[model samples]
Target: MDVSIILILLLAGTLVTLFSGKAAGKVALAFGLLALGASVALLTKFNAHQNIGCLGVWMENPQIYFALNGDGLSLAMVLLTTSLLPIIMYSTFGSEVKNPSSFYALILFMGFAMVGTFLAADGFLYYIFWELALIPIYFIALNWGNGDAKERQKAVVKFFIYTFAGSLFMLASFAYLYTKAGNFLIGNLSALSLSADEQFWIFLGFFAAYAIKIPLIPFHTWQAAVYQKAPTAGTMLLSGIMLKMGLYSVLRWQLPIAPYAAKTFMTIFIVFGIAGTIYGSIVALRQKDLKKLLAYSSLAHVGLIAAGAYTLTVDGLRGAVLQMISHGFVIVGLFFAAEVIFRRYQTREISEMGGIRVQAPKFTSMFMILVLASVALPSTFNFVGEFTVLYGLSSINIWFPILGGLTIILGAYYMLKMFQNVMLGEANPKPFADITFQEGLTMGVIIAVLFFFGLYPKPIVDMITPSIEQILSYTHKL
Candidate 1:
């Protein structure tokens, strides 16, 4: 089957589902499953060693190319995209969203753009999809948000402008590189020789874009508000999958292409990452809103991932990738749990919730497991990822890991405190309900994945190692 056909099928399905009305949920699910299967087939047929250019043309001076190419890295991201969509669609079934057709359409379209971002070999083409992915999400947040109209609009707009500003700098960086390389293909740009001065400026542009997206401290202001304001499904998608795009790009574009600059300025990057981790944890400890707290905690976790990635070791890269996957699952479960609590209490404030576990043992149990995972407790996926990252950081500097390790303490403090306030405190006078079948199933799947991969993470580590090797090889050549 043609890859283009797969893309078309997804695009067409989203369009068709927009007109499906109430049945849109079912239609979207069917299309998502089909897309997932087709993606798997495409993976099997993909030639990892060869470049698959789609179409190209000559510009005024430089040549322009539009293409889809897959190597280990792009394929891994594509797999992540396809694997998550069906689950997200399934999770949405439990949601009480209005205008289901438009909601599903936006989600499917977002999936299409995410896959395109991973597959596009040309820098300009990739940028187009990078920006395109944000559009559906903006609408998703605006249309489906839970907060008051003004607050939701403000959050969505803030997210949009912050990310867009960073993207523009990224575009400028790529244009500069294109002038020197005379080609827009990532491989060609990676091969081009660049001076340290040039690499420094280019790296800045790339870092600005990625930092805001992954949203390491300072730049993370937009996230908690947006997460709190957006609907549950939108929050899941944003935290669970969309944030990975930034981290993935850091690996795909920044490291390999500007190795010397990265190496020279490594300390600054590591410092920023560590600062974000500590700062995020400290702030999360104070948040009253459950979703906002989880959002800040996620910021802290991904900051550690970023620090590990910059360590430039095999273990560091592998751990970062694994953590990306693990965090995605853990955060989805966390946000889903938050949704359940909100449905019962009609509020996300922890102080307003209590005795929830009395009537909702199953819900409480699942929430506890997810919280443990988020806090990096032993025998969970978070533990495996966090341990590996620390080990990776240890090789760079004992102090780096030592300072970064503070997150574990802070993470536990806030997480357990939130749990104690919401679950262990005296029962509130208001009535509470037990967990629903759908909610239980969603959390069960996430918890099972957490433990399964935590106990045995070698498979994903091995799969990702080859791509890390390929990326690191470019750095060595530099």
Candidate 2:
């Protein structure tokens, strides 16, 4: 598994997809299939004990390396990104975009940036990819987004400034760490010693970046608007894969680099996360616009994932990783469902939709499965992750789990309400079409993966546990 191939293929996909003109979606899907093949090869070749690389010595004086590697943690994320790319492209096959070429090109480029972020083993390389990931999405939203021109501009610009500013803080912190350690390798940074106060400051700097990316609580003002305005593909990128970058950063960078600070402020971070969970759920309950509702729902779920990370226990960390994957699949499916409804009715308001189930039972059934998964029903993938996270929270303190558990009740209430408004009740008088074959393929694939993992999660649990344990050991040693 030459890690470089994944990046090259994605970049090539971007160019080929762009040049393919009106068939850009098909071109992108072809490239995505190729990339998935490469990722599968990488997964088979990956050895958790050794850092695999096709290139090295990217810089001299700074001693940076182009050494792309895949531990279990990174490979899982890379697989997720590659797996979703084709589905996302396939979902767009029937649409007439303003510029199909550029639209699909940006999506492919976004995939490259995200894969780079996951596989990057050097600190500076990680930052480069982190900032690079933001660029494509910004353009996607700014150029192709829905709603008023001025409003979309404001939302995209605000998202840009917010994430870019946060990245600067992260860069500053990394620079300080570089000066102290004289290198930018992740291993070196993790091994460096810092005083409690220094660790606290570094932690704060990283927190600003991750929090904004995760968009926890007060820092989340940019998310709902940006998510609502971005074109569905762009929004899928943001919610499905992008948010996990922040949560993944916590496990990969923040906790290990600033162990004392992580330990010292664990309670505060958990409390803030719980607050975001409650706040997001409550706000979602009132949202009339379906996109905004899912956006807020994402906020709530991610908050719980972040809180689980702060728990610093095996169950918590594993649950966070598992839930990240679950949320990625389920949320993408849900948003795609939203787009399906919008395509038929040309409206995103819940009040405007009714009795879709009567007209499109296949679509309705799939949507119901995803909705139930989101609400964490038993025998579904989300249930396993949520249960583990709750168990982790309970291990820390009973009240923490108790408070976070409100998500179960709130999740069911809001999700069921949204489903009832959009899919049930008296049938709409307007003619409605059943799910198209392409749409069914997309939804069917996602639903199948969700069900498979729900019943047998041991494979993923086995792959990620060692990396999570390694992270825990490093934090504990400090």
Candidate 3:
């Protein structure tokens, strides 16, 4: 009931906002706040030791349960999703984005799908919500995206087809599991006994979807163009939260169901993830477009996160979740900064930008802080997560940490280079305005979280540690 309330509020907000016409953005913000309130209520109940909520037999012949269970992991993700919605909505205030009603409505719907994905306990229900998320984002990108029509169309289509095709493999795996377990419940699927061969195929099936979504190395070709073409809001949804869905699925679905296969192929997955870390960093260093640069930066960060999870160590899983949350906040802030830049300077090319600090010191300062965080500065939230991940990788092999840690140097190099080129040069003749009050609030909230967690990460680490232990226990038994 508590979790469902969040979804109901969002879906209801979607309808209300659609009907709100010109006032849709305001309505959307209001609903986002309400949903955030519900999220708070859920957390409160969780703290007070109350049942969060669960409703089963809610869907099809195969059957899917609608659950709002607030385990540590789910609660953390719920909080991330709800909190980001209002901030994301607020970032759009006073802007003219064609049909404001539809745009805001899609944002709410996208939140609904993500929350559902986080809370779902039934495999079929999880799959449904997972695919449901793609719909809103697809339309969001297809309609609101900025670029040449042909380019936008190509990017959106490729993104859509790539993700959808990957999902079919997951669906097939779920069907096979249903046959083996006689139900679609996650518990049953995780507990079902299977041979090494069976586990290998199942793991591969899940990996297909996850790899495409995470877009690890060879699978990531579609991401840069799609991110560059999409509007800033759409880019945030994709980079900030949507991509995490893939990484989260690896923890929630892949490892548990196919522990043997996961163990068997652990090195393969880790190598790919580390390869992506190095590969994405190299690509990012060369990007002319700021959005594309950040997109590749995101890829590199998530690569390390993925590598952490594949380690199957408690520290690795813990680090992965922490990084997911931290990355979500940081990436959104960075993308918003990019949007703010685009709004002011009318270009995303790093070559065309310079002396922003002279013109807009406030913007430069905030952007610099975010960049520092992304580079895992010692006092930032990312530092804790990145350090933990490197530590986790080290357990597998000292070399693993050594290789994966390249991201830190590469990240700082590209990030500082971009910042120097864009924010620290001679002032452009045209007046470049500093961040407005709204932009400041958005970036400020994110920075505050990063700082707070960076200094004192024990609360989140404590909350998620037991859950990480539970997951690691499953892997150990296998």
Candidate 4:
């Protein structure tokens, strides 16, 4: 099957999940597996030099196409999305969602939009997929979110407005690109020539959207709130896969399409990225809520990843991809850890958790491994990305790496402290039960991916290098 099959399967999943009655969760799970299976097959075909892609004209007047191609870079992201869907679904197996049909459908629909965002090769079509992704999550967080109904609505709306407004800038940017090139295909737009002023404004417009989406520092106001209120699955999708949409766009859309603008303002954006790293780490140290703390921690990591990307070196870009994939799993694992705790303790506040490690050795072990990975412990997959990114930054400026590297120390400080508080402090009066088998399995899959990739990053590194180099050739105007 072609890459379009992935989109088709997910879209089909959404519809089937919606009308499947009480078996929606199972239907969603089956479709998630089918999507995952489809992506794996594509990856196999991709490695064997088969063109696992589909292209068709969606509109003749505006020069748009329903294009989906699987280069190493795009395929890696597709794998991330497909791999996480089933995991996210499984992560919630122990909990009962009210209106399960709608809940599961929203998740599948969100997956559909996100996968499209990754696979879309046409600029306007990409923007459409990008915007389509926001709808399901808005409903997910608004309707199924925790906390007071009014408060959930408020947070979800804030998130939607901030993201929606940011996307307008992107839309405007694409409109300009269309005028210049008269086509929205990635190849045409990436090769389109424009004046410095034009590239600058276009770059800024894309940056506004990407920054808000990746949520680098000042643009990050909506993140923690929505994370805190959304259900765990929504949080997983947002942090794990949705945010990568921005980082991926940086290499795919921002850098290549406006090479001169990217080269000129690289430092400014790098500074923004590094600043977010430090700022997010600092803020995370103060969050009383577990999910909110993980949210900020995610901000810190993505900031570093973004900073690495703007370095514009092969190492920087490749490291960003590696980090993005690793971060996707690590962040999901961390948030799910929070979910596991919440399920057992009935509270997300750090103060309300303690001494669970004594009762739940299996869960504690997996959570601890995830914590270490977040801090970029040696030999973990995270270390590979973090070290590569820091190396890339160092090639530019010693202080760039120094500043960006702060996420490591700061992350360890806050994460370990949070872990200690949640799992290792004095025993609480309430009895704590160990994780169920399904929950253990969920965390186990995540931990296994982190370590396996950590030890053998060469496969991923080799796979994505050509695509990253092709992108850099554009940025370097070679």
Report lDDT (Cα) of residue 433, candidate 4: 86
Residue-pair clashes per candidate: 0, 0, 0, 0
* Model 1 Cα lDDT, one tens digit per residue, 370-395: 99999999899999988999999999
Model 3 CA lDDT for position 418: 94
Residue range 1-478, candidate 4, lDDT tens digits: 7888888999999998999888999999999999999988877767623435788989999788988878899889999999999999988888988999999999999999998998888988899899999999999998888999998998899999999999999999999888888889898988888889999999999999999999887999999989999999999999999999999999988999888998898899899999999999999999999999999999999999999999999999989999999999999999998888888789988988888888888888888999999999988999999999999999889999999999999999999999899899777788878888898899899999999999999889978998898889986663
Residue 92, model 4, lDDT: 81
In candidate 2, how many Å is residue 358 off? 1.5
**Pairs in steric clash, model 2:** none
- Overall local distance difference test of candidate 1: 0.86
| lDDT for each candidate structure | 0.86, 0.91, 0.89, 0.91
Model 1 poorest ten-residue lDDT run: 51-60
Question: Residues 56-137, candidate 2, lDDT per residue (tens digit)?
Answer: 8889988788867677888888889999989888887656688889999999999999999998878899999999999999
Better of 2 and 3 by lDDT: 2
Global CA lDDT computed for model 4: 0.91
TM-scores of all predicted structures: 0.95, 0.98, 0.98, 0.98
Worst 10 residues of 4 by lDDT: 43-52
